[model samples]
Target: MRMGGLTVWFWALASASALLLGPVVSSSSTTWVADGTVLELDDSNFESAISSLDLVLVDFHAPWCGHCKRLAPQLDAAAPMLAALKNPIVIAKVNADKYSSLRDKYGVDGFPTLKLFIHGVPQDYKGPRNADLLVRYLKKFAAPDVTVLDSDSAVADFVEAAGTFFPIYIGFGLEESVVSKLALKYKRKAWFSVVKDVSEDVMMLYDFDKVPALVSLHPSYNEQHVFYGPFEEEFLEDFIKQSLLPLAMPINYDTLKSLDDDERKLVLTIVEDEDDEKSKNLIKILKSAASANRDLIFGYVGLKQWEDFADTFGANKKTKLPKMVVWDRTEEYFRVNGSETIGEEDQASQVSQFLEGYKEGRTIKERVGGSLSLTSFISSFLGLGTVYVLVFVVATIILVRKATEEEPLRVGRGDEVDRATSSISEAESREAGEKED
Candidate 1:
């Protein structure tokens, strides 16, 4: 049975190749046709062959399709195997560009549309043009039942009926970040009715340091939210509500800012030993909490391989190791010794209490008063103004003194004539007076 099945399969493939290659042209005693040959189908012989065949496999192809080029050789190899089939199928070719009418008639939009026709009736086929897939489709449905439609028109028709609710979520590689899991969870909840490839575009847009970047788009609006680590279920639920639904609580940061009497709370905690596992875990939890909620400002000073990370938190030789500080824009401050073992829950609770009391007091800087001290500012301004005034006064005095200095006069022809005339007049007067005497 297996041998018989193999024989049938081989025969089917050969038939497919012969039909796919081109129409067979007969020459002599053995009736040699152009089987297993990739050739052109022109207007001259097309019509008569279409009239003769019960099943005509017309490949509407272009030279540019890589898949079509690949399909050509495979079609050639299958030609001889096809000759053994009881009811033989013939291969034909149509260059869609040259035969524009044929393409227009079939409504062919994309290249290499394979159409199987029987008795001039069209039926069912859609594709990526894989030969094996095509063979299976033919075997299951038979050649006559499959119809070919124009790629563009067929896509348009399907899209119209495809339905609403398109949701697209984009994320980074799962191995790179924990955010990938959150992104996938969101994708499943939203429904895969609509999906898009946003990998390249999102990576550039966000200047994303890391991913999984989750972006969801609906008919009404689009939402993008980013997560870096393990996200709590409740927090994620709230995020979706805030992002998608209009009636949702504003995220925690907004609520903190709205308080009329908000104080900047600062807390400091010190850990004695740097190499302790408890200290590292506490730091991790604190950082995670700070990342998730901006309610309390958290800073860490570590002394475990402390030299390596010392530069990161601005810690130096003078500063003590295993120190944690909580600072609110600067009204209230608290310090704790880090030589102790403090769990994540304890740290969270302590920080939360500190902020609550701190905000109630409102000892922090107000917008107007926080800029600078009035006395210092005035003194600084006056000092600069005094320096400028002295500079101007010195420049003016020098300019006046320079202007008052004597300047040498140039001897011109007019001055010479005046001097000479006065001298002559005096001499004449003296001579006249002497004569009168």
Candidate 2:
């Protein structure tokens, strides 16, 4: 998934790789500093510090935020180790609450927002929060954009050192110059390596039969796609873009935001619970469909896991579970005319029919969160603010009506309306409280 232009996948991949390959070791021969300190910055020095550094990871945080407080010591612990790199990444933080103008300039909407600045250009830091993982993640930035693999051992070592956090592209029997430009272009997204020496075992391992093959490996997903390319800039870039996402992604806030770069609409499956046996079986079916229909992104969300988010797609406790829809990831979605729900029997056939119907335009288009406005789009996140605004508007209307009334209102009807509004307000308040917790 792409997080602020930096594509990331499951962190579980990194954890598993650590277990199998052990800790990552730097190959730099230069002597490094053993002690380094995190820099404290404010509006006065923030610009100067970022502009002067080749690489800087800045934390925009509020002092009182619980998450920010927890992250402080981790950054402190990581500072010295990160500073010891050949191309050291300086760690810094600003009290965003105290410097509201600086916070607004950087568009820091939430506490503990970490941004990595590469020569003053900022990209969001969405990697691990733990000290060791953070240090390992930052080390990737300092490595060469494209590494040349000379031997079988080098290939094995490169893959092992890469871990599973980023996708790896190894060009077999291809020139370094051919992929050098792309390697630089997508440096933040994936690792690129050109293998000059090709072996039979390496060929079998990567599952490619020919030379001039570019293999894209998502180690996290244990998935790989081979491109026997014309290798032109456009075609190569297209392959790289498509390779960024997995075949079947689980829907959540981070994954949803990742779709911003991909133009393909989502084939979203909504289930009662995503972790259950039935959902797992259905995901296998979805993955099969995804392999064939690469133009559409296949994703699944559990209603039980994220009720508020699922409700945006017209799902609720009363709605039938395991529903499918084609979502544009914005305000509108499409529902197949007759195949709104998926059945337990012949599930694969049902999915095939739904896709066929959608492609044939035998579906109903519907808008989500009312009219297409920025406010409505933003309200789709949680929607508690929208609820409060609606409640206030209704209360204002009732007050205006009562003040303008010249005669006594009907007592029973007035009490019923008051009770109804009160109940709605109370229920919304409770929900908002729960969300804060």
Candidate whose TM-score is highest: 2
Residues 1-437, model 1: lDDT tens digits: 32333333232222212222234433232232434343355566555555444445677765545545677765554433333233445555687646766765665533456676653344323322444444432332222111122333442342332222222333343331333344444432232111123245545553445544433333222333554434465664445433332111111222222221333232333443433786656555554454444444444434433332332223345554444434343332333332222434566665444445444653332221223332222222222222223344443454355544232111112222232233233334555666679
Encode model 2's per-residue lDDT on 1-437: one tens digit a residue: 01211111111111112110112222233221224688788887777666666677899987656678889999999988887776677788999767878776776545677999987888778688999989877878877888999998999999988888788999999898999998998888789999998999999999999998999998888889999998998999888887888888888755665666679999999999999999989999998999899888999999988776677778888988899999887668999999999989989999999999999999998876422233334433323223234344443465455554332211112222242233333334555666679
* Residue range with the least summed lDDT across 10 consecutive positions in model 2: 4-13
RMSD (Cα, Å) of model 1: 35.2
Q: How many residue pairs clash (N, CA or C atoms closer than 3 angstroms) in each of the candidate models, in the order given?
A: 21, 0
Candidate 2: residue 40 Cα off by (Å): 1.4
Which 10 successive residues of model 1 have the least lDDT summed? Answer: 245-254
Q: What ranges in model 2 sit over 4 Å off?
A: 1-35, 369-437
Cα deviation of 397, candidate 1, in Å:
77
Give the whole-model CA lDDT for all candidates, comma-separated: 0.39, 0.74
Error of 1 at 141 (Å): 6.0
